[model samples]
Structure formats: structure tokens, C-alpha cells
Target chain A: MSDPVISVAGIGKEYVLGVSMSGNMLREQIASGVRKIFQRVERPNRQQQRFWALKDVSFRVDQGEVVGVIGHNGAGKSTLLKVLSEITEPSTGEIRVRGRIASLLEVGTGFHPELSGRENIYLNGAILGMTRSEISRKFDEIVAFSGVERFLETPVKRFSSGMYVRLAFSVAAHLEPEILVIDEVLAVGDLEFQKRCLGKMGDVARSGRTVLFVSHNMTAIHDLCERSLLLNHGELVADGATGDVINGYLSGLNTDASIKRKVSNDADAWVTDVRLIYEGSESRQGFKMGQSLCVEISYETKKKVEHLGFGISIEDCIQSTRVFASVSSIHGIQLENVEGEGRARVCFPDLKLVPGRYMVTITLNAKSFQYDRLEGVRILDVLGQDELGTGWVLSRQRNGVVWLNHEWLLDGRQ
Target chain B: MSSAETTEMPERIIRPKTGLIGVNFRELWRFRELFFFLSWRDVLIRYKQTALGVLWVILQPLTSVVVFTVIFGKMANLDSHGTPYPLITLAALIPWQMFSNAVGASSLSLISSANLVTKIYFPRLIIPLSSTLGTLVDSLVGILLLFVFIFGYLFGREFGLIEVPVGVGLHWQLVLMPIFFAYALLAAIACGLWFSALNVQYRDVKYVIPFMLRIAMLVSPVGYLSSEIPENYRLLYSINPLVGVIDGFRWSVLGSEFQPYWPGFCLGATVVLFFLVTGVMFFRNTERKFADII
Candidate 1:
């Protein structure tokens, strides 16, 4: 085997939590300086806390390998990419790479709004590490891909947001680096444009280039990358095949105890536990796409209650969107008065959620007052397939929550 | 998607570089084209929506000449060393405006372009370096205006246009323009590096700059003649960086009528060099903290 195109040893980045972000005010700094002179002594304040944004992350990717980085918020995925791209320095350790690397931590970087779209294409291209000759050679292709050909002469500030994003993404997509580090920039634009971006990414991956992709879209990662790395709380938890890594990530979420809300001392009535049922057994939270799934909620009430209203709210945790609030009131289910301990089970025989992770919030209302509203009571995962075998993978956020069954109706002589 | 394309660029190692003089000149040379684009974009954007466009370059110094002529020449009766007040003040304002505007813009260059600084990695020096360079276009125009005024006075005398004394000789020493321009450019970049770096952290530099430039113009040899200074305090007054720059411009343009105080010029040039060294040190030291705070 040839040498790895990118080699990263145990690199770490530490962000001083308080000192770095805001020692900015000159007056405060001056005051501190003055106080230092008067005190005639120095001391290390215990408040100076060092938060490691990335800790001891090591990985290597051979040429032509597309590796996906999966992690939750603040999991050091972005920090790792920033370190590799040299946008910021790693506090410790070193990285060696054999090729020129360009990172698209954001698209439309350095685009001047007052400049014409044509000018910005050149400006943004240069900023993204594309030489002038390379951009000039591919100028027509970049404009053609953006589909905003007529507005190229106009200033970009006047262009609609859709046109702006398309042009920006188009310029970024044409950058041909030996190693590319991308951070969820593909999550922009509409579905059709995202497809073009993915297509461009695939073309890049096939041409003996290395790609390090960081994104929350598991389906996109699963469809594009052969290998993946999973990060949890600044540590690399797993790295292997895309399927296995995503499976491990999803199951890790489901089994995590912190997902379940703790006991609420203020509420007279509250939920105790939420369990998942798949195929008529108390299985873990992972459920197959387009299959029956059940969420059985158990709760305890201290005193007698009337007309107890219980419902479950499923939120797309990755997307930060609410999928549904299937309350007993909304679904026309009635409840009896005096309650001590009771269980409510809601099941969908054909749950058509787009495959991703979700957090459920139990909303239990007693008459006019809110008894208990437990957020993140349980984390669930929906596993999907490219059922039509068309190689189109669904994105949980880019596409909506519900997956409607339909067939292509493009006409010929039908 | 072919694998045949190649540039043979060298491999780069990424790690924390600790020291005062870690600036890699080769890396900076590799990104020379980007510096051109950044300065080009700045010059292009500056005149974009203005009604006068590049004409504002000539008009701005003309207005300053008129204003300073009224304030210092007509009323205060400051010595012009026998050159016409407008011509003398214009010569001095040329370098002064170049220094002030470039330094002013560069003081805030990193903040205004924070988006690019945070998202992309190039030599961070390019931001302020480009800002200082952006003023070169205006200086070129302002210098052309000085030439027209000089030859206009020379020719206008033959046609007998009503004349004030034609004190400007257009002497052979004018060939030294590039040397004094080096002084102005270095002074601008030195202040640009210092203020732009500090502005990234203590944004008080932003509020302090414009006010400081106003005070700097009054103290520098812009409105009044440097000959007006007493001999005892001449070297002390040369501590201001622009003292040499403004005096050098007048001596270059107005000829022997306005001789630059050589001792003061040497002192001011030393001061500029001093700040430039410390500026680079401060800039390189603080540059790593920018992407984090900014």
C-alpha cells in the first residue's frame, strides 16, 4: 500500500475558557495592570480554566479515501478540522501531510457583496486557495454549475439568497485540492443543489484525492464515505467502516443514560421511564424505517388527578426540529381521574421517519396546570435504506421528517 | 477528475510556532498573488459607489490644501519658506494623508475583514499589509497633481498668468522621491501592523485611531513649516514618524527653498524603523490569538 496522504498524530487544542474569549477590553486590562503594580505580588488565579476542545486525536487517511467525522455538538469535530486546516494552531502534537490542503470551513468566504458576482467568483476562488489560472480555466464550468448566469454582472448583494448560496457553493465546489477538509457546507442550498455538491464531492474522491468530511448528516456521510470516525466529548470513540461507525454512534445515543430526564421534585406528577418496543419486544431504541415502533411511557401521580393529558413530542435532535406532538388531546384520547401509576403506549404501525436520531419529550398535563414536561426523555434512532436502489440517500434535516412513499411520475408516453 | 494534474508544491507541517520572528518569507512569497488581489479589491471597493470615483483622490488633497492654506497660511501666517502656501501645504499633505489614511484603514482592517480571518488561513500579515498598500493608488494620483501644479506654475509664468512667487525649482534632488516614499510606506505599515494586531484584541485601538490621527496631523509637519521649530527642540520634534515624511515631501517637491532638517529626518527615520521592528514582533506574537478572539 502507498503511504497515507494525511497523517495526524496525537494533536490537541485547548481553549482557555474565560481568558481568551474576552480579555479584550483595554480599560479592564489597564486596570489589572495597575492592580498588579499596587499589589507587588503575582498569583495564578484558580478561575483560569483550560478547556480542551480537542484531545489526543490521531488518524491517518490514504490517498483517495473519503473519511467522515461524526459527532454531537462541541465534540471537537470542528476543532479538529480547524487544526488540520491551520485556521488555528493545535496546542500540542504535530501533523504531517504530503499534499496541499484547502479547508472550506465555510463557503462564500471573502466574498465582497459590493463586487459583481463575476468579481466575487475570482475573489472567493483565490481565498479558497484556487490559483488565478485554475479559476480562469474553470470559470465557465463554475458559472454554468451555479445557474445564475444572467446575474453574473450584477452585484451579489442584490441577488436573492438562493442565488447567493448557489454561486458561493459553486465556487467552492470547483476547488481542486490534493486534500480537502469540508465542514457541513454541503448542508446548504436546496435538495437539487445538494445533489450537485455530493456529485462534485464524489468526483473529487474518485480522482486520487483525500477528503476529510465533518457533518451531522449521517445519511450523507454513510452514502459518500467508506470509513468514518466518531467523536464523543473531545475524544475519538470509534473509527472504522461507515456503517459500523454510524451504528455504534446511534446505539451509543440510545443507551446513554443522560438522555432520560432526572426526577422533577417540583412536579406533583411526573414521568418515571420511557421504553421502546420493536417487533413486539422490549428492544433498544433503534427502529427500522417504515416499520412499527412503540413508545411506552410510565408515570406516577402523588394525588388524585382529573382528565390527565399525556402526549409525546418527537424532536429531530440532529436537525433541532420538532417532528410531531402527538398528544392525547390532539389525538382524541380521554383519560380517567384518580391516578397513582399508569402507562401510556403510542405505536405507529408504519412509522415513516427519515432515518436519523430523535429525542422524545413527554408532556403530561393535569387539568389546567402542567404536571410534568420531560424533555429528552428517550433517544430513538431510525434506520433507513435506499429502498428504490437509486443511490439517493435521505438527509434528516435537508429533507423533512416524514418520508412519504411515492413513485417518480416523469412523463414520456404514460 | 484525472490524477495527472500536478504543481509540485512542498509539504507543510502544521504546529504551534512559538517565537518572536517566526515569519516565513517563503510562505509569504507563495501567497504574493493573494496580496495583489486583496489590495486590488480594496482599491476597487473604495471608489465603487462614490460619484467622483478616482477623481476624489485628487480632490481630497486639493480640499485639504485649501483648508490648511486658510487656517495656517492666510490667518496664522506660518512660514511657507517663500513657496506658495497652497503648493507647500499640498506637498506636505500628500505624504501626510497617505500615512494617515493608510494607517487609519489598516488599524481597523482586521476587524472589518474578521469574516475572512476566522474562516481562511493565509499569512495574517496580508490584511494590514494590503491596507497600507491600498493607499498607493491615491498617492500616485496626488503626486501627479503636484507635477501638474509645478509645471503649471513654470509655464503659466511665460503666458504671464498672475503669479505668486514660483519657489519650486523641480531640482535634480527630486529623483529621491522613492527613498522618502520608502519612509512613508514603512511608517504606514509599522503603524498598520501595530494597530491592526492590537485592534483584534483590545478594540479600543479602533476608537483611539481616528482621534490619534487628527492629533498626529497637527503635530507632524503638515500644516506649518518645520523651519518654524526652534533649533533646540528640532530633534525632539522629529520623534514623530511623519515629521521626516512630510518634510521630505516638501523638500523633494518645493526644491531648495524648503530644505529638510537633515538631523531631524535621521531621527524620525530611526523612530519609524524602531516601531517597525516592535510592530512586527507584536503582530507575529498576537496574530495567533486573532482567529480565536475574532
Candidate 2:
């Protein structure tokens, strides 16, 4: 194998905390300078603290490797990309990069709102390190891909945000830089454009170009990257094949389930506890298809709220797809009066969900006002069941997400 | 677009380095297209909707000359070295307008493009440099108008429509106009680099620029000639740098009796060089923090 295109060793980035305050910075600096001169010795303020955005982050990407960086907010994913892009210097260690690099920190960077779409194509192309002739070479393709040909001469300020993102991404994707560093810019634009972006990214990866992609969207990461890295609190916790890393991240989330909030707004109602309980057991695990499953919610209301009802929404954790939603009010089963502390339980006699991890969101509300809402408050892991009597697990690979009760009759007359 | 052998491409090490040796020339050269586009964007946006698009460029210096001619020439009767006051003042206003507008916009360049700085990975110097170039176009227009006035005054005096008592003629020193203009731009860039870097960290620098320019206008030889200063303090006064530009500018275009004072011009040039070297050093030192802080 050839030498790695990008190599980073012991890279650390440190930021001084709480230095930015909303005021005239010159006056503050002048006052500080004067104080230092008078004192003859400057000391760091007590309120100041040191934050390490990245610590000992070591990685190497061989030529033409597509790697996905997955992490939650404040997990140093952005700092890592910034360090690689050389937008900011690392406080410690070294990074060696080969070939031309184009980094897309956002869509439509360096685009002037007053300039027309045709003009912005050239401007944004140049900002991404594309030469003038190179932009003209791909000009027609970019316009066609963006689907903004009708408004090509109109100023970008007049274009819808979706059109703006489409044009920007089209120009960026046409760039032929050897190495591409992209942040979560795909989060913008419509679903169709997002699909096109993914397709284009896949083509770039297939063309033997190195790519460093950072995103919170797990499905995209799984689709485009064969290798993945997991970051937690500025540390590289895992690096392996995409499946293992995603599994490591998802199961890691299971331990932090049952999120509770102390919302003081109105204080009408708030959830205190939320969990999925297996039938006849306090264990929170071992949920199975076609098994009795119960979702228990403990909440409190400072004042009596009429028509109080509990709602639950189930979402597919991996794809973030909403699977089902049901509310007591919609079922015409609202409580006449609810006050103080109480426990509410919703039981499914035969849970029809296929085997997968699902996220549950609970909401407490009345007729007109929403008291509180908590999303992803709990995780339900459903195990596959053999409800079809096929001697094998009833899995989504065969039966889809839910099981249906149906009878099958076969007549053998031959 | 050439599919050349990859062996020809140079590898870069992105280690943190200190001091003046840290500039990446190859990277800057590769992004030259961006530099041009950014400058072009600024120039195009400035006059997009104005009814008299490029005319505003000439209009600014012309109106300023009229105002200075009325107040400084008619009311105050400030000395103009025996040349037409309008000719001499307009000659200096070309470079002065260029310097003021360039420095004004360049200093605020980084602050205004905070989005680009924090989000992208191009050289931060491009912002100020492109803005300076954008304003250079305006200065060129001002220069064109200065010549029109000089010839107009010559013809108008012959026709008895002008009352100025001095001859308006070009001199051999006009060959040095490019040198003088270069100095003006150098001075602007020097201050621009310093103030643009400072503006990122201290936003009050933006407010300080206009106030500082007003004071600068009074102290520099914008409306009046450097000869009016007492002989003893001429060297001290010429240290302002714009004094040398104005002095050399009038001498070059108006064919005035005032010659280029070598000592003051040299002193001013040295001061401008000092600002250039120090401004670049300081800007490079603080640029890495711009993305984080901004």
C-alpha cells in the first residue's frame, strides 16, 4: 500500500475558556494592558480555565480511503476537521498531508448574496480551490446538476435556501481535489438533494480519492464509509469497521437511557421516570417480538390539569425513522382530572415490532397546552421472535418491521 | 485538468510554526483565482444598483475637491505653492482618497467576513488584500479625473474663465507618479494589515477607524501643501507619510515650485516600511486564533 495521504499524531487543541464576552473588546484589552503595566506582573484570571478540544488524537488515512467520523456534539469532530483543514492550528503535535485538499465546512461559503447564481458558481468554485478554467470546464454540468438553470442569472439572494444549497453543493462536488474534508453540510437541503450528495460522495470515494467525512447521521456514515471512528469527550474511543463502530456507539447510548428533565416552565406537568418494562419483570432488557411489552411513565403536575393524556412515539434508532405514534387523547381515553404525582402505563399485548433498537419519546399535555415533552427518553431493544412458526427468527430482513396475523392454507391436489 | 504524474506534487507538513518564516507561498499561489474573484466581488457589489455606477468613483474626489477649494482656498486662502489651488488639491486627493478608502475598508474586512474566516481554510490575508485591491480601482478613477481638471484649468485660464493666477503645466517629475502611488498603497496595506488583525480580536477598532481618519485628514497635507509648515518642524511633520505622498503628488502633476524633499520622503518611506514589516508579523502571529475567537 502507498503511504498515507494524511497522518496526524498526538494532535491536541486547547482553548482558553470564557474569554469571549459581549462588549467592546478594545476597552477590555486596554484596561487589561494597563493593569498589567501597573502591576508589573500579569496573572491569569481565576475564572479562566483550559479546555482540551482534542487530546492525543492519532490517525492515518491511506490514499483513497473514505473514513467517517461519528460523534455527538462537543465531541471534537469539528475540531479534528479544522485541524486537518488547517483553518486552526493544533496546540500540540504534528500533521502531515499530501496532495491538494478541499474542505467544505459549510454549503455556499464565500458566496456573495448580491451576485447572481452564475457568478456565485465561479466565486464559490474559486473559494473551494478550483481554478477559473476548471470551473468553466464543469460549468454546464454544475448548473444542470443544481437544477437552477432557470434562475442562473438571478441574484442568489432571490433564490430559495434550498436552491442555494443545491447550487453550492453542485459546485463543491465538481471539484477534483485529491483529498476532500467535509463537515455536516449534508444536513441542509432537501431529501432529494441529500440523496444526490450521497451519490456524488459515493462516486468520489469510488474514484480513488481520499475523503474525511464528519456527520451525526449514522445511516449516511454507514452507507459511504467502510471504516469509521467514534469520538467521545475529545477522545478517540474506537476505530474499526463501520458496523462495529456503529454498534459500539449505539449500545453505548443504551446505558444513558431514561432521560429526565426538571423543566420549570409553568410546572404544569413533567416526567420523572420513563422505561420499558418486560412483562412480569422489572428488567429493562429482553424485549421480544410478539411478547407483552409495557412502557411506564412517572410524572407530576403542580396543578390539576383536565383532559390530561400521555403520548408515546417510537422511532427506529439507526435510521431515525418514526415507526409509530399513539396518544391517549386520540384514543378518546383522556383522564377526567390529573394532579400531583402519578404513574401511567401503556401495554401492548403482542408487540408487533421487528427486532431492532427503537427510541421512545413521551409527552405530557392536556386539551390545549403542552406541558412537557421528552424525545429519545428511553430505548427499547426488541428481540426477534418466531411468531410465524417458521423455525427461524421473524426478522425485518424477511417480514418487514411489524408482524401481521394472517392464516395460510395450501391445497395439494397434484 | 492535466493528469500529470502525482510524483510532481509536493507534500506539505502542517505543523505549528512561529515567526515570519511561516507563510505558505505555494498554497497562496494555488488560490490566486480566489483572490481575484473576491476582489472582483467587492468591486461589482459596490456599484450594483447605483444609477451612475462608475461615475460615483470620480464624483467622490471631485466633490471633496470642491469642498476643500471653497473652505481652504476661498475662505482660509491657504497657500498652494503658487499653482492653481484646485489643481494641487485635486492631485493630492487622488492618493488621499485611495489611502483613506482602502485603509477604511481593509481594516474592517476581517470583521465583515467573519463567516468566511471561521468556516474556511484560505489565507486570512486574502480578505484585506482583496478589499484593498477593490478600492485601488476607485483610486485609478480618481487619477483619471485629476488629469481632466489640470488640463481644464490650463484651457480655462487661457479663455479668462478661471481666475487662478498660476500656470498649470506638467513636469518631468510626473514620471514618478507610479512610485508615489505605490507608496500610498504600501502605506494603506501596512495599516490595513495591522488594523484588520486587531479588528478581529477587538471590535472597537472598527469604531476607532473613522475617528482616526478624521484626525488623520486634518494632520496630513490633504487640502494644504507641506510647504506651509514651519521649516523647523517639516521633518517632524513629514513623518506622517501622507505628507510625502501629497508633496510628491503635487510636484509631479501640477509642476509646482515645491520639490520632493528627499529627507522627509525617505523618512516617511522608512516609517511605512516599519509598519509593513511589523504589521505582517503581527497579523501572521494572531491569524490562527481568528477562526476560534471569531
Q: Which of the numbered candidates is closest to the native, going by highest TM-score?
A: 1
Tens-digit lDDT track of model 1 for B1-294: 323332244556787777666677988998887888889899989999889898899889999999999999999998776678989888888888889889988889999999988888899998899878887999989999988988888887778984647566578769988888878999999999999998998988988999999999888888899888899999999889788898887787777777788888888888888999999889988888788888
What share of the reference contacts is kept in model 2?
0.69
Q: Write the per-residue lDDT of candidate 1 for residues A56-149, one digit (tens) a residue.
A: 9898887789999997768899999888888889898889887888999988999899999999999999888888999999999999999999
lDDT of each: 0.84, 0.84
The deviation in Å at residue B277 for candidate 2 is 0.5
Collision pairs in model 2: none
Model 1 misplaced stretches (Cα beyond 4 Å): A34-47, A257-357, A360-377, A381-400, A403-414, B1-9, B163-166
Instruction: Report how far residue A408 has shifted in candidate 1, in Å.
Output: 20
* DockQ for the candidates, in order: 0.49, 0.45
Q: Interface RMSD (Å) of model 1?
A: 2.2
